[model samples]
Target: MNKAPIVFLIGFMGSGKTHLAKHVSGILTGKVIEMDSEIEKKYGAKIKDIFSEKGESYFRELEREVLYEIIATNIHSTAPVLISTGGGTPCFYDNMEVMSGAGTTLYLRPSNIVLLRRLEKEKEERPLIRNKTRDEILEYIKQKVNEREKYYLKADIVFNPVNPDIGNLAQLVKEIIYSSFPYFG
Candidate 1:
């Protein structure tokens, strides 16, 4: 059995990190943990409600705690683990540092257009960008992508994950898995 190699997936919201984690977890032979879902379960409320009620600070605090806890799990587990971090996970705290130190970090790195398209369809589910116009979504993505680029670039591996063939992403990740682990270079 392949031991858990500590894979941290990072990207903007709707960039498919969680979806890709699901796929990768299936084929890559690892347990999966999603930071957002973990937080929601812990708080017994949706992340949107948490943000609205307690403000982003509280959510950030919870996110940090969860990410650290997940990192600890990976450190102790013997099997390869796939972790999907929140969109802003790396931007705040020393998450990038923790991730880089503990595991291989991969950025889903979807294009703004693709991200906007995916986000538009799911806006209702995500209160942060709900009811936003297409133009507004585009602008928001641009600003977010810009602000988060520095944090995102800290990933050991970055790839454009959008495509006509989603399965290709799994192959790409597998290639990375075989050729090199993050921070090994």
Candidate 2:
């Protein structure tokens, strides 16, 4: 079997990166590293709280630190490693370059309508759109997605699922990795 030691999942908020990472890890028997969760655990504060207290720049710095830490510790791991990055992770610093160089980078591109619907349900949990009205949130999603697409499109693999099936998606990723590094087996 081909083993991709690390796989980074990048996408907009509410794009199901964490969920897909968990599913992929379960299938591959790998470790799942949620960057936002890691930051929250390390700093002892929710992400929204971090954004409010320390600001976006501080939070982005923390994100960069956590990303490097994860790579440094897991680069040589024997088992697969699935990393679910924050929406803006790739857009900051040289994160896109670092993650792409480290291992496979997968971009999860869901439709804007889908993102809007998902974000609406969990707006309060998201610091960026927490205070925005429904209409404002839609506009924000459109604007942010357009701005972030450049960074996100730099990923090695882009998986745009019309209706994402976690199981199938995980298997597809495995197949892609297997194809990419046939000598790994």
Candidate 3:
């Protein structure tokens, strides 16, 4: 029997893709394929280290490969996993094309101020963003968000990071999936 297609969560840093992906995965009986974690495993280092040592250009190559692999691997995977990608995944390379082609792409949006706060707390863990100041981070987010919005807008669904409420975020995910495409259930 043919399995359902995969789902993708595309957004900026601190936009909450990982958190939401986990929720939807549970509700959908799908696995969560985290692109960043896959890269770290291949290189045997943290994502921050990959950026620091190999640089963004190199990391992008790995990102593309992982995205491709995830889709190919899950083409026959029942339950269909949710993919949480890095902030820049859509901006660079052909990742956006691959993601949108693979399955549904959802955008998880939070306010810019909220993102600033979230990024501030974890900049160290995200080396590409560690050197940016508050204003710079905000500006960068604005610029990147603007650029990626075109791709993200192609998603099958969009949700506010706060509206569904984090506590029930998982439930919301399932509800969205079931309601939007009940046949998948």
Candidate 4:
């Protein structure tokens, strides 16, 4: 039997990576591995607490370790594995290269307006934008998205979802994945 494909969903926070992963996994009967949740579980702390206590450098190291561990454990599975990575996952280390080499990387590109609206409501939960005002949050999104575009664009598939609904987006992603890897379908 062919080894199942690992689909890495890459995008900014609030771009629906986790939602997409869960939806796609349901459609594909795959496993969803949320990188941040895995790290939080492994360290026994929430990500915000981890960042506040250990610094981003330390948190990034942990992210790298978890990314590799996820790949190693799931790379040869007989069912699909959908990995929903943190916003900064691909921008650090050789993560983009590693993910692309291991399996398909799908970048979910949404407009800045869409991101700002979604992120503003959830700022308290996100460490990077927790204390920012509305304008500051928008500025931060623009700057970070610009900086991370290079890494995100390196994905094998770049999907710009005009309609951000999970059902439609998930169906689109499923079709793209099937087209890319026919055997998986």
The lDDT for every candidate, in the order shown, is: 0.82, 0.88, 0.76, 0.89
| Per-residue lDDT of model 4, residues 86-149, tens digit only | 9999999999999998889999899999999899988888999999999999999999999999
Q: In model 4, which regions exceed 4 Å deviation? A: 1-4
Q: Please, what are the lDDT tens digits per residue for candidate 3 over residues 26-103?
A: 667657778888888977988888888888889888888887877888876656567889888877777777777667
* Superior by TM-score: candidate 2 or candidate 3: 2
Residue-level lDDT tens digits of model 1 in 1-185: 32337878899999898887777766765577888999999879999899878988889999999888887767866556778898999999898888888878888888999999899989988767887899999999999899999999999888885474657787677667645533222
Off by over 4 Å in 3: 1-3, 179-184
Please give the TM-score that candidate 2 achieves against the real structure. 0.93
User: Which portions of model 1 show Cα errors greater than 4 Å?
Assistant: 1-4, 162-164, 178-185
Number of backbone collisions per candidate: 4, 0, 0, 0
* Prediction 4 TM-score vs. true: 0.94
Superposition TM-score, candidate 1 onto the true structure: 0.90
The collision pairs in model 2 are none
Q: Is candidate 2 or 4 superior in TM-score? A: 4
Q: All candidates' TM-scores? A: 0.90, 0.93, 0.88, 0.94
Choose the strongest candidate by TM-score. 4
Tens-digit lDDT track for model 2 on 1-185? 33346888999999999887777776665578899999999999999999999899999999999999999999887766779999999999999999988888999999999999999999999999999999999999999999999999999889898887779987887666555554442
- After superposition on all C-alphas, the RMSD of every candidate to the true structure, in Å, is 3.5, 2.4, 2.4, 1.9
Give the lDDT ranking, best first.
Answer: 4, 2, 1, 3
For candidate 3, the TM-score is 0.88
Cα lDDT for residue 163, candidate 1: 72
What candidate 2 gets wrong by more than 4 Å, as runs, is 1-4, 181-185
